[model samples]
Target chain A: MSKRLLFVFAALIIATMVLSACGPKASTYECTDAIGCVTVAPGDPIHLAYDMVINGPDATLGIDSRNGVEIAIAEKGQLLGHDVQLTGEDDGCSAEGGQASGTKLAADTTIVAVFGTSCSSAARVAVPLLSQAGFVIISASNTAPDLTKAGDPNNWPGYLRTAHNDTIQGAAAAQFAVDFLKVTKAATIHDGSLYAESLANQFAKVFQELGGTITAQEAVDPNQTDFKSVLTSLAPGGPELIYYPIFVKAGSLITRQAKETTGLENTSLMGADGMFSPDVTAGAGDAVEGLFVSSPDTSSFSQKYNDYFLPKYQELFGSEPVSIFHAHAYDATWMVMNAIEAVAVKDADGTLHIPRQALRDAMYATKDFQGLTGVLTCGPTGDCANPKIAVYEYHAGEYPPIKVWP
Target chain B: MLRTWRQRITIADVVVWIIGLSIAFVVVYGSIKTIEVGKYNTRVWIDLTITGLALGGVYALIALGYTIVYGVLKMINFAHSEIFMSGPFTAVFLALALYKNGFWNSHPYISLLLVTLLAVTVSSTLAVLLERIAYRPLRTAPRLVPLITAIGASFFLQYAFRGFFGSGLQAYPELGFLKGTWTFGSIPVYKTQVVVIISALIMMLILYGFVQLTKMGKAMRAVSEDKEVAGLMGIDVDRIIMLTFALGGASAGLGGILYILLFPVVHFFMGFIPGLKAFTAAVLGGIGNVPGAFLGAMILGILEAVGPSLFLDGMGIAAPYQLKDAIAFIILVFILIIRPSGILGERITQTKA
Candidate 1:
């Protein structure tokens, strides 16, 4: 009996060692294989990575968006009883750079979720590789309508964005034009790029739907200097408003020219999220004084970001946060951690079991989770529908949000 | 001479002319078709003249750098583009820092002027140092050696800037003094456009005078014509070459500062395209010829500005936007194939032994 008991004890000890070796150490939840989706064991440290463009010309809001993500990640640590590590990748707001950053992150097995690609152009290139690799990519500001359209068969399962689609913003701008401003005749100009054209088309469709006449629609090259002839030709029968869906560089030039030729000081000029930067106001000077632009209001989360991340970001970057892209980057880190925590399961013998599909499903299952962008609930089509957008009027050399729309 | 001139229009010339005409016709036809389609509510022929002029200013500024260096060294300085790009990046950062510190808001013009002076000084110094360190070592080496060194230097500077800056678009803070629009009927010309044109013309005149009239400039020409003979005559060939690069670098730096004022976006790769375009301008104007480079830059700029809407868009090409680059290259290839000596290049002569 004593020899039989000794043999059983020895077998049990050997079994425990083998099981522990197969699983990640109990201290941290690490994904080792492609089998079952793994969740962070209770009291296990989780590593998360948020890849996004942090620096660049188009990164005005990117900085703020990243901060929002960081704040959420910090908050998650205090509430969820798990330590989280966050890392950022600068995509330079270019498609080529975005692809490289995506590839780099996907190759790193520790990065389970990615939060950025603030520009729709960058997102279009990054989504396929990240999704194919089974990493969840959630954009905080990508608002292209086709991205989440269920009608499109090529919809990515792992791709999502917290911002409202251009369709919604377009309709809102149109409504504001027709109902609020009571503008009967309007002209629309786009910078002849995907993002600009997409927003312009959506606005045109909605403007027509709301019984407004679009007198002129034109496409301008972004790199060109003189926009006089284009602006002159656009001046037919004196349109009451000009809807320009373009970025700051071209938009500033257009605004300055529009004011000079068309007396835009008397006419109301409106634009989309691309025009909502201090650079626009500065570049356009007093020409953009009355210009009204609409974008998602990230001001509510400013205090939260400052409280959690200002000291660290300032310590490193030595500047006050400029944009909201930073907030989105920060949230991307938390979202991945949340996914890892939800699906990671540990066996009795300390073996971690995780399936890639389960982590993806958990990302879809996220509901009513309070994120820095407000309460988050990703829809079946991978869109954060009904995000609140705000309109700001440039006055006294600053943009102050005047109204919030549903 | 007349018969030779007529026969000089070779098969290559005919092909180039035909291709150019065909492209022009297609663009005109497309514009008409687009108007007929009426998918767009408004159809307006965007004026190419103004765009061409503005583009020419940039081309002229960049071409001057190439021409100046080529005139002195008889070798293409491939690293000049990187020098140009560095100017804008530095200017933007300095301007921003100054703006943030309240210097710009108080005296915008003075601050900008100071920035420009600083940018020129820094760029000129860098240009001279680069020549002393990289090119001077390979001065007596094979001609290909210096050319290869130049290419390497260009790449090194580009990547080094990228690594240091962390590869994001740097948005320049606006200088209020440079903001305004001048309109001719429906045609609107920006203040930056005026600045670009005026600055380019002024710099070109100054450079032209320096090369043609100044003692140092005459010495540069003599060295360029025959470095060995000029050296024997007691002229410091190396010093002249260094001065030539410094002047070119200053011009490029000035161009960079103006460019950022217009576009307000700067990056490490910013110099690559502009550099190539500037080189094209140099060849177009007759590479070693200063006035020719100026003229060629203007023409090229105008072509780039007006070619898209007038030629490409008129041909029913949906996105004639990026076609500017292709159009420029096509022109470049045709010029090379048909007119190897360039539009204003001196004809080469052979002497019987």
Candidate 2:
């Protein structure tokens, strides 16, 4: 080996050390972060990655959230004198999809922050990886309590969400069922998905606590087509209302088939936010009429949502929001951007250094942040929603259902 | 007879027999217990049975594709599911157009016919193309080669459709005529279910006759029995094989339409579950036997519908419906154990080699 090259390397290191000592000149950026930093060179875009389901049955959920993110990027074209680049992969809204996207996103060190995972099942497997990667991870529509519960196995640090925890949404639905609907007996069906399972269980627990009889608690596969037998079995219980907090496909099938079931002809059917897409009306046809679904009450969203943001969204996307989470997604994107702005260090040369740990701290420290879906606040473990759930009723062929209960 | 049986049976055979009998006993006991409990009425059972029969009809149509293809090619056309998907998935656009223009309700029969025809044509064309492009080149390759290619072809077709149609559910329009109930004596049946059942039966009968009573059907059986010998005796083996694929695919397409009638939701990935069930049905009845496929599909359909409540409910299992698919696979295991050749599967031949 050459002694000359070794001497040159040593001199270069000493020179850098001396230069760093004089970094107070405000011309150079020093990264004193515990974990590391993402450096965006001059004229390079500040890259933010997303891991959301972009295909399949629940594509509406993820694509809508992504549209929110896209809108946010367009609104904030430049951040701290750098272009904001949004790039990412699809999670497919399944556990395997989560693992695949997680592994891929984790390996890419360029990502400054990430937000996504429309479904709770995907987030259960994906969040831990993104969290471990030292990126501030947020979700737009992951409502399962397990993701945000303190010290739970599925919960991870640096993961926060703008979506309401199911504890609030589920109990609210139960209360409405008992107090408003005046239904003494009810049934619940879940598709065995983490989101649906926990949500249905929460609804059942709260319903029983509210002096309502849970006639039956059942489960179905998300891919299952025939719900006639299950509906038939629920008949003996004489449930006045059947609350199925499942996704669109199965939810629609149950809604249609429930009407056909001999004994269940008179039973009222209800679903949750997961089933609150316009697709439900199309999928269930006329049976969608009188269907009740509990979702985030859009009426309570900050005024800009309707006055400015929605108009901008319509102009940009050429359609109404397809799913319920777009506003939540918009808030999540702004939260990430604001956090990045709070922690990132800019050099006079136009390059920027974003310390990952400081970014996470800034995100978790959020409070009274005025954004869509109401004023947002983050808890220690990661719950950060000003949750306002309301139940709405659908009349055939019409959507954006009228909120019938508070 | 006992001494001869003792001489023939091994320890494994005895073990299998005991296990099979125990499962059988549990099933019988469960059924008895459910009836004794009287939680469900005769009406409930009747409705469930009718639902099962309607769905079973669709399964039979899809299963015919698998059974007939296996009979001739000795290769499981794993992509037959996609062929089933291509038909209705494409026809949905036409159906929607008819629906949006108010022609669907005004002329429900024409709409059904048009959709069915488009679905059949699309399915048959895809099946033939799949045979020519994916399977033909690998016919002489190792057995696993074509099998693997079929799976690859299946994925290719699925994503290609996804690319073309976008990965979202395409809701099929409901016909007004197919709404409401037609009471059969004291029992009431939805018009859609009746249509599905009748259409499935007619399709199955037509397919069975075409395969059994036609001259080309004779040539197909000869080729399946001995491909090289049949070819030497003036059979166009390649053409016969393609026809087999077309026929199978057409039935699958028709089956898909019936499937939508019952379920009413269509998508690029819709074919996956039904395709899998139909394959299982084909294997259950007997892979190469048409009638056996139909019988297997009916049993499977009925079991999936009634087994959960009838069997599991008696055993005090909660949410038995979730275990519905589990019951289907368990019954398949039992059937294989008791009769590994399936209800009517022929003995494995040199064709398998």
- Could you list the CA RMSD of all candidates, in the order they appear? 7.2, 3.2
Tens-digit lDDT track for model 1 on A1-406?
A: 9999999999999999999887556445555545334354545555455556566556665666776666666556542455666676776555776788778777776555777777776676777777777777788778778878896743687887777788888887888788778898888888765567888888889888888888767777665544654565455446799889787667877776677553344767888888777767666665767787877666665466656566766765576656534555555556666677677665664444456777777777878766656677778888764465666777636654245342
Error of 2 at A387 (Å): 0.9
User: Each candidate: how many clashes?
Assistant: 43, 0
Docking class of 2: medium
Estimate the overall C-alpha local distance difference test score of candidate 2.
0.90
Model 1 alpha-carbon miss at residue A173, Å: 2.1
Fnat by candidate, in order: 0.11, 0.66
Model 2 lDDT per residue over B204-293, tens place: 788788878999998999998889999999999999999999999899999988888888888888888888999999999988988888
lDDT tens digits, residue span A76-151, model 2: 8899999998888899888999999999999999998888888899898999899899888899999999898997
The candidate that achieves the highest TM-score relative to the unseen native structure: 2
Candidate 2 lDDT at A182 equals: 94
Q: What's the C-alpha lDDT at position A343 in model 1?
A: 72
Worst 10 residues of 2 chain B by lDDT: B344-353
